[model samples]
Target: MVQRLGSIGKLLVGVWLAGVTVATFVVIPPYQGLGDAGRIVIVHVPTAWVAVIAFTVSAVYSALFLRRRRPDDDAKATAAAEGGLIFTLLSTLTGMVFSQIAWGVFWNWDPRQVTILILLLIYAALFALRSAIDEPERRRRLAAVYSLFAFVTMPFLMFVAPRMAESTLHPNCAFIKGSDCNGITLQVGNVGLLGDQKVQLLGLERQGDIVVAQVKVSTPGLASEAILRPGYDLTTRSYTDRPTFPGQRFTLALESVNLERGEARINMEAPGSGLLANQRTLWVFLASNIGFTMLFVWMFLVRSQVLSLEVQIAQRKVALA
Candidate 1:
């Protein structure tokens, strides 16, 4: 069974490599400001996800080991935690590289950055505690308990804590945008699908023309205001205002304005369609996620085999005595 599982794992590793290649070379377009460096997203984001998954798996098995007193469950838990740590380290390194490009500094002590560092230390301590114990059963029991205790901090650090902070440039805009912005919803067509009916700024652009500008949408009841940069020019048909630099995140808002009719219509450009966008980002996201998940499973299978072999060797030594 171990050999068969190992063979399957080897095959999947090749698949993972292929997926990564495609994600890097084919999918995912260059982001604004990030340019080609944004390709690191394929590696960093996936590794972080795998790290979280591996830790969760370790915690689950640790709970199972305590409940049933199963040596196999303990083995699985230990192996999973080790794999999780490896991915977490990779995630941290990649994130640091990305930070250097985006924030102009390698280590800025951001909230998310500090939290991940703390997580790494916690798991490192888990391994240290296991190593100090000489007896197999005792070591397994203690490790299982420690794993459960340590896991309490995972969710808080990875998800909740970041949200509570005033602001973060981590590119996690799903929960919140900027410090004051609650959320963002793109205004499309003749009327908004959501929010109150209020046309704050009308007659800014000509009645029938394409406007290339950055639009910032603030949620309902918020003091935040939307900004359209590089004000439109009738003659040049180009943005002459403040142009966006590379790697900056901005949405290209398309709208039709008519002063006499008092009608303004706008819709966000499809992702990866603009000159600054890369279409393959979504594909890269999928490939990275699937590839690393397979890798974690493979690592677990190999580790489990080694652990079982060690157990057999120990039993044989006692029998000889």
Candidate 2:
């Protein structure tokens, strides 16, 4: 009966993921500025999120194995880690595709990209460590300790380090809004940093209902500079024209303007911002997340069961010998 229920659950997950794949292209609308390429986020983000969950699960089972010295716990931990590695690879590949379309390069050494590559290498080493050991018990013990340390780095690499970067084309704010993700405010003649660019608000000009802020942007070390005029519509209280930053696809936008105070909030926008603003896009994206999580659970369970059976068979063979 339990096996029957498990089979049913697997079938449901398969159906659910198939539906998500269909909805990704057919239901969700193309994002502003990104067009069809933005749809990659539906798969890309969920895979990365699932990778984090899988690694956390692996770490928990590894802890249990260390405390109880149970082979079953070791099997579960290995299975979860394997699933995590697979999902991480998927996330990286999808992100590269997104980058090629949005940034005109497959790899730009962006902070997020660099951190994820490092994470992949770290986890890959854990499996290599497991395979190098001859004794199963010693291998599990070492892997459990190593996995805990790897988990320690996972949070910092995946979350903290990328955000700490001064400039990144990753659209982190598009999915997860934060105070720091908002741009900077500058008054005329005041200097501020936006991403990697140093900017000074040179002046503001009003053309009827539209207000344009002339921002002088300089590269690090003041190597070069360009004047960007980002326009805001006073009547509509929205951005009118967002001009592309020099030498990059990302655009500079006037988020808000206070004419009386001679100040404006200016920010850099990547290609995929406001992607979830549409109702269909949000619903589909949420559904994709749910589906991928379920798929991860299924993979973890099946892989752990197989590993447990192998351990049991090995024990039987040793006893007979």
Candidate 3:
């Protein structure tokens, strides 16, 4: 049974490594529509997931080590935490890139984004705290307890943040998109390692219409504005004969915008045919989130063994002395 368990562990690790290769070399870039820049998602998303996983694993190992009085768990926790932090930083940078593309700005004070920055800080502090302690047992206990606090705090950062923001650029979205996971869930079938879901954005274009200019204005200023020609019908996604005046420039309008100082809820509509806007947000959230947690569970299991090995080596060295 022990040998079989070891074999199974080896197989799982091998497959995971292979999956990482596929995720990087094949799946991520094509799926996310990230162009050359999209390659970053593979690094960013996975890093984030790994980071969260690392911290979570560290906390768990800390708990287990406390209960069992084992040294191996302590080492494993440290390794996971270290790995997690590296991935988390990478993920943040990737996100900043996407933000620049989609929102026309590199950094926004969106609650979720800000929270990630905070989480990174906490983990950094954890590392410093661990290094500061000289006594091994004391270090383990302090690190584990801190990990526990951080684990407890992380979900609040992910969830509770958006509610507190008043005027923010971040979209308040959910994970799991409420779609029948029946087809998607089953098709992707326990393929937890494969998270290459695609998000599609659609807009109809006329034969000769030109995109003249894009103006992002304050809400009140949008109330009386007509950016596009009156004849162009935005709702039907159909328009009269395209105007060739502005050379390949498409004129788009935002409805219900403020002419003076109110918020402009730009009339971005959910796709009537395919996935809705809210649905997409939820998908992005989930596709990018769960792995974050699961990664730590991986760390917790792996870390315990490493700590034991260190204890053994230390004992041998002491005996030799």
Candidate 4:
């Protein structure tokens, strides 16, 4: 009965993931600036999210192993860490593909990229440490302790560090609506920084229902400058045109304007910033997240069982010896 139920659950997960794949390509429309390359987000984001979950699961089991010294708990911890590593690798690979399509480069050493790479290295070291120790008990104890310390870095590396960087080209606004993602307000002749770019509002002009702001943008160190005219539609209360900055893929967008006050809120928008704003895209993205999470659970269960079996076999061999 348990085997039958497991089979049914596996079948359901397979069907659900297949549906997500179909919806990802067929249902969701191509993003405006990113084109079809934006579709990678469905897989990329979920894999990254699953990696975080897997690491957390591993940490929990590691703590349990420490408390009880149960071999099964250690097995589960190792299995979850393995799953986390695989998913993290997938996230990195898919991100590289997306980067190639959107940024015209495979690797740019962006802050997010650097942080994830560092995280990969940290976890990889844990496995290496486990393999070097010969005694099963010592290996498990040291790995449990190391895993707890490793987990302390995961949150900082994955979330906090990337956000702290001021000049990253990552589309943080796609998932988060933090103050950094929100644009800065500037009056005519006032200067402000938008994602490390210095911007001075030069002038504003009205053409029909559109309010156009002439923004003088300069890169860090005043190395390059350009005059950008981003347009906002007063009637729609949205940006009509986002002009790309000089020598960068990011665009300057007018978020809001107060004509009477001569002030405007301008921001730097990365490629695929508003990709999830579409109803179909958002629904499919959410479904994809759900599917990936379920898939992780399935993988973790199977892997942990196999690891537990191996541990049991090793114990029998030790008993005979």
Off by over 4 Å in 2: 174-229, 232-239, 245-250, 255-265, 270-273
Q: For candidate 2, what is the TM-score? A: 0.81
Summing lDDT over every window of 10 consecutive residues in candidate 4, give the lowest-scoring window. 171-180
lDDT of 2 by residue, 145-240 (tens): 999999999999999999888777676543332123668899999998775568899999999999999999864323578899989999888887
Q: TM-score of every model?
A: 0.69, 0.81, 0.57, 0.78
Question: Per-residue lDDT for 1-321 in model 3, tens only?
Answer: 966876676666566655554554554323222234434444566566666666676677778877886777778767777767777777788788766654445675556688889988988999899889988789888888888888888777755775565434332121112111111111111221101111111222223332112222222112232222212333443423222112111112222222233222222211112211334333443444444444445554555566567779987998999
Clashing pairs in 4: none
Q: For residues 100-141, could you state the per-residue lDDT of candidate 4 as single tens digits? A: 765556777778999999999999999999999999999999
Error of 2 at 318 (Å): 1.8
Model 1 weakest 10-residue run by lDDT: 174-183
What candidate 3 gets wrong by more than 4 Å, as runs, is: 1-47, 171-307
Candidate 1, 20-95: lDDT as tens digits: 8776866665654446666787788889899899999999999999999988898889889999999999999998
lDDT of each: 0.66, 0.87, 0.50, 0.87
Ranking by lDDT: 2, 4, 1, 3
